[model samples]
Target: MSTLIGKTALVTGASRGIGRAIAARLAAEGALVAVHYGSNKAAADETVAAIQAAGGRAFAVGADFGTEGDIDALLTGLDAGLGGTGLDILVNNAALAGGTDLENSTPDYFDRMFAVNVKAPFFLIQRLLPNMRDGGRVINVSSGVTRIALPETVYAMTKGAVETMSRNLANSYATGKRGITVNTVAPGPVDTGHPMFQIPEVVEGTAKATALDRMGEPEDIAAAVAFLASDDARWITGNTVDATGGMFLGPRF
Candidate 1:
């Protein structure tokens, strides 16, 4: 499965969870990886170490993803890490969950969520597009809440924007035989070490929501991203490949 043998990848929010798993998966498939982190230096280093231990090439990079100049700094660092070479893969997976709801939503929360989950990645791709080699791959980590309308109004709206961007970018690059491909991978009720699952109501509710009678693991989503990044998946783009383990399917109970 060395489909990415000659590729270079930048995976943001790669310090832990799905981001960490995707970073390792790409490295394992033989891509030179730049693992991006936000304030989790140790976790980023650990990702690098684990990849290296498995005989994969990877490095750790850091940037604040929600602020001005932060994304440029991240791109600059990634380029330097690759020795000014072209990029072949990008996983825009870093995200912040604004606990803001209907009544408590603040101007600051809306601003921050849109900035990180929508504006930043959208522009970062634009800045890096010139450097991305033809036939490149871009996987945006999205959520199923957009379809289910789970009350994460602000967060889900931003990811919805990502979904639309991916489809448009895929069409934009459709002319080239080996041009870039962009797609969103949406997961539902993933267990990313958040303590919310410990709450009895949350646990029961999520379990009932999913036909699998459980939640998704981070690796499940990462595995899907790895596949989409491969040449075998070159024909798959401009689509939302749901990875929710039947969570979004079945008759309403």
Candidate 2:
């Protein structure tokens, strides 16, 4: 079960929800994990504690992704935590979720969304590439909204950009010389702690939209991500794996 033994992984936004699940899953496979958080140090610590309690190794790293010098801050903390080891897996999972239609979206909100969801991952990867091992894996958490109509236009746009980045990066590294893999996992209607889950009607509607007849849980998406991060996925890259429970499976009749 220790598929990732002697490896290291960094998962952003590991304070809670999907990010936390991914971190825990990777650590379970014996990866020494760096659990990144924005401002929720307590939650990040809790994540690390849980991993440790399970006989896994993990540590908390803090960085506000959208802010200036964020990549530098993250790398600094990561370097201190890793001591001298290079990274084997990097999961870009931090993002801002709220966005409205064009008419309702403000310039500030759009900018912030792109900054956190798009710009941060771009720079984080750019900076981390040097430290990532030759056979490393880079996984971006994307949204299924990119493939379907969604009211959150700006959020979908950000995920679209991430998918594009993943494709280009994967192609760029496809030579097999370095063997690094870049990919995206797009999840639909995940039952995270987001406020949208507060409404019973919305939850019911979301469940109905999926072929599985149930909304996805954080672990569901994490399972897909875990598979992609493993050696079995060595040949897969530059693609979006739909972890959406067959959401939007067919045209509405």
The prediction achieving the highest TM-score against the true structure is 2
lDDT of 2 by residue, 41-86 (tens): 9999999999999999999999997888888999999999999899
Global CA lDDT computed for model 1: 0.87
**TM-scores of the candidates in the order shown:** 0.93, 0.95
Q: Among all windows of ten consecutive residues in candidate 1, which has the lowest summed lDDT?
A: 171-180
* RMSD each, Å: 1.9, 1.6
Clashing pairs in 2: none
Each prediction's number of clashing residue pairs:
2, 0
Quality of model 2 by C-alpha lDDT: 0.91
Q: How many clashing residue pairs are found in candidate 2?
A: 0
Against the unseen true structure, what C-alpha lDDT does each candidate score? 0.87, 0.91
Q: Model 2: residues >4 Å from true position, as ranges?
A: 173-176, 251-253
